[model samples]
Target: MGYQYQLTKVILVIIFWSLNEVIPIAWVFLICGASLPPLDLIISKDKYLAQFPWELYLFYGYAFYGILFQAEQHLIFLGIGYSLSRLVLYFQLKQSLNT
Candidate 1:
């Protein structure tokens, strides 16, 4: 099912956002009626690459019932932000390197 896919993607991807970034992302979802996950989100040695708090999904307060759904929507936005930020970083580095 789509739920499995979202969980897998969340577990696998390497967006590399800090814990600080995660709170805002969750807060955004929470504001949209998605409940916040537990305070102790993850127990990973590498929290940077882990899931964005599983409790929110468990609560399922907000329903992104469209084709994309909740986590997927967040993911698309995250991907866009990641790509744009990467592009900026690459360009800035290139310019610095040329100078």
Candidate 2:
């Protein structure tokens, strides 16, 4: 298969995995499960002793670049949002450490 074909397949797989198409009843258990709270709150919450993982932002940079390079899609706003979030996380982490 060509690069575009492969990239499309990869994106489709990611979407499917995120949406829980891999298992018939997984979405209900994962997303619609009343026991579990929203994950965004946990991820975005500030921590006093814990350091944020900047590598995830780096992965996002890679994904944004990949989209731009392969699909000719210019997601400048998303890139800017990512950059701002990275800065916020960096400053928050810096302030958390006494050193």
Candidate 3:
């Protein structure tokens, strides 16, 4: 997909996800189940330490960007996660192939 299209889709999903804060963390559970950490895990909680069942309710309160207490903190953590993953992917995927 084009970058703009992808971004718009992501924005919409984010908006939809944030629209209903009453889901009870169903997405968080599903995300964790799929070996993905939702935005909340990176900020106030550790991904490894989060329990699937119990954190479900708590995660429901999270915003689209996983803002439990502070939105900026959530955004910072999300950027951190993205940067880390990008670095990993760069080293493991691109750099490794040349080595």
Candidate 4:
């Protein structure tokens, strides 16, 4: 199950990344942002939840397991790097949106 979960995440990320390149929409922020959904979408509670990506939870799971067990040394640094990168991306988007 663990192996399959990681494989699925890799595949999904690749697929979505490719899709984003083709679609040219800011869908990644809507799906992965730290902030609340846009005020207009407040009318539909379900829509906000639907936009939340479950893959993030899995990513956290992988990081936690890797760090706690110290089974995969690479995962810890990789996870930190990925998280920091995401943080920068999110804030950049937030600043742009605010302006």
Quantify all predictions' global Cα lDDT against the true fold.
0.38, 0.45, 0.41, 0.48
TM-score of 4: 0.40
| Model 3: lDDT of residue 6 | 55
Error of 4 at 17 (Å): 23
Model 2 over residues 9-92: C-alpha lDDT tens digits?
455455446766555543323333221112222333343135564545664776567767863223333344444555565566
Quality of model 3 by C-alpha lDDT: 0.41
As a TM-score, model 3 comes out at 0.35
TM-score per model over all chains = 0.32, 0.31, 0.35, 0.40
Q: Report the C-alpha displacement of residue 37, candidate 2, in angstroms.
A: 18
Give the best candidate by lDDT. Answer: 4
* Distance from true location, Cα of 95 in model 2, Å: 2.0
Runs in model 3 deviating more than 4 A are 1-8, 11-71
List RMSD in Å for every model shown. Answer: 13.5, 12.4, 13.2, 11.3
Task: Name model 2 segments beyond 4 Å from true.
Answer: 1-49, 60-64, 67-76, 96-99
Off by over 4 Å in 1: 1-71
